[model samples]
Target: MANITLFAQAIGRLPKECIRKIIREEKTDKHSKGYDTWSQFISMMFCQFSGCDSVRDISNGLNSANGNLNHLGICRAPSKSTVAYQNAKRDSGVFRRIFYALLAHFGQQAVWQRTRYRFKMPIKLLDSSTITLTMSLYEWAHYTTRKGGGEDAYIA
Candidate 1:
């Protein structure tokens, strides 16, 4: 039997070749001395998985899992300053592209075939609600008033 962390099992399903191709095309690692694009991507994924609130949290979390870094394909945990510098300087488009690529890949999985609906298209459900705010309390809010009353508004 092989010992496999959940993180490794999940990430193992991704097409590494495709991700590497995107990384090469995007040149995300260009001019990076130590913390390269791959390290940045892994660190970001770690932050997402661990629900880290800040760079220091991410650093601490990774440091605690130092022994498992090899399984994550990273040589070592990144420092807070390194993570912050890469985040500030690296092009966000690379990550965006990778996200879309992964979405497309996972969207075609066999698990989605068992949908209850006959329609094969993906369905997204959206709901809306409204909250009244006092003009004195929320002076910054500039909601338009209809002749009747407040119907609904999407803040986000």
Candidate 2:
């Protein structure tokens, strides 16, 4: 029997060929040397699995798991700034396409085979409501008893 890290086992379910195809199609790694698309994907996956709240936490977590970097297909842990930059600059469409691709792939499994419906298209519900903040707790909102003043105040 061979020993496999839980992370490896989990991500191994994804089809490598499909992922590579998406990578080539998106050209996300173009002109990048070290921290390419694969690195960014792996880093984000780590953050998601480890429940990291921020880039610094992801960097520190990866740093601590230095010995497992090879297993994750990354040469080294990315810096907090690098993670932040990639997150802010990278095109979100690449990830979105990858997600739908994987979803379609897995939906073919036996588990989902029986759940097919007569609908021709899938319906996805989205919640676009802004986060609610209490004026009493967030005094920076400049809430006052005066009407028509504090209603438009938002944190972001």
**Segments in model 1 whose C-alpha atoms lie over 4 Å from true places:** 1-3, 110-156
Candidate 2: segments with Cα more than 4 A from true spot: 1-3, 110-156
lDDT of 2 at 155: 32
Backbone clash tally for model 1? 0
lDDT for each residue of candidate 1 in 1-156, tens digit (9 for 90 to 100): 988877778778877788888999999877988778878888888788878899999999889989988776778899999999999999999989999998888887856776565768766665576566666666554476422223464433
TM-scores of all predicted structures: 0.67, 0.67
Q: Tens digit of lDDT per residue, candidate 2, span 29-51?
A: 88776888878888888888889
* Full-model lDDT for every candidate: 0.81, 0.80
Count steric clashes of candidate 2: 0
